[model samples]
Target: MTSKITLFQHGTGAMIVPGLFDGTIDIQELLTHGDTGIGSGDGLDGESIINNGTPLLIRGDGSVTIADDHFTVPFVNAHFAAYSTINNIQINDFQSLGNYIFKHHQYQNILFSVKLHGQFEWVKTRSVFKQSKPYPSLVATAKSEKRFESQHLSGTVIAYYYPDAFSKFAVGGFHAHFISDDQSIGGHLMNFSGFNGDLGIQKFKKLDLELPIDNADYLNHDFKNDDIEAAINQAERES
Candidate 1:
């Protein structure tokens, strides 16, 4: 199959009402679209990862668990990652690794899927705790975020390189989530070092976005001119 990334709902949509959990799409429906991707569970419970064909949930305490196929998610980005190459490369740190990938990829207006599997000196990650009714906004949740760090471990980093032109609707640059080989720990990647493994690269030429028309929170909410960019940066990146 040709490489394509299907983004279900915009990142901005989640910011409008941070914990909107009444989404219609379930895990079974999601799996039909793609096998490898990342998303969040209902109530922003934890970091959801669809690796191969299994769905795993990474909690705030850095614990891994199997996700129920019937569980719902408000946002998801996935694809049947068909890579062209899985090359071995030496990477010093996170920024250098991104630079190295960019060197091979010259296009600035296209989307790309990436998977790096190997050993690392250190890796830092974060996950969202489940929220209750009358949930807080995304920015507020980011302000008091808790982070987890692992030293000298083997893992895989699943990521996407989204173009800047779609900044408002999605993650502008690289958005990544990580899981260890043991399946004991994982979350949204904040910082990491040493990419000593096979790096899979797949360039995507088409992007299909699915909006939540059945969900009222998504339909009646105001997504225009929101601080989605800032909130995403704050929640997903290191301070």
Candidate 2:
């Protein structure tokens, strides 16, 4: 029998929408769930990309650095599985990539992971500045985010696809992050002009979600009062 692929998640996007930026799950413990994934640091410090076993922190200034093992993460999606390489195709932009995946993959209701590696004609990204006590909602934080763009950059794009049914727990659609080959630039991917590379995809049959059961903020927050869908659409998508 074939083994089922599992997607391990540390926290929910819903929690972040309400500004629950503190997390008890450390990078050291998160890595054990999967060697490859994407997430953010405590207080929304930066965008995190876990390529293989290395966790990289992309700061608001578009600076990239290795994340400390002790650094805590408020939200993360990770999985351990080998990707099946799809034929190289011309990707004009981020939307095109999404269309391609939807048209070819035929797993709309399922969760999957995508990895693209090669040269990009141009790439656009953004990262949130670290927040302090009495954190602001993600939508508010995104308004003051730092945006970066580069031309002819070589790097990898790590992303996850969570169907609409999973929106309450995670981003409803494609949520992606980028990292250059030299590890100099990367963040929450806003868009890309051109992509010439290999596409690899893996579909997960099961989801292993770990919530912050002991977190007062998570337990106390009244999520029903918030427009989670609207907030996520505004804060996470290209504006």
| TM-score winner | 2
The sequence of per-residue lDDT tens digits that candidate 2 reaches over residues 1-239 is 12339888888888998899996689888888888889998999999999988999998888888999899999998877589986566799999998988888798999999999998999998998899989999999998899988999899999999989988879999999999998878999999978998999999988898999999989899888888888989999887
lDDT for model 2, on a 0 to 1 scale? Answer: 0.89
Highest lDDT model number:
2
TM-score of 1: 0.91
lDDT tens string, model 1, 1-239?
32354433323434434545554678888887788888877777788888887888897667798888798776777888777665677788778867887787785678887888899889888887777667778767655556888888999888887787777667778888899999866888888887688888877767777777777776666666567777666666677
Model 1, residue 81: C-alpha shift (Å):
1.8
Alpha-carbon lDDT, every model = 0.75, 0.89
What are the models' TM-scores? 0.91, 0.96
**TM-score, structure 2 vs. true:** 0.96
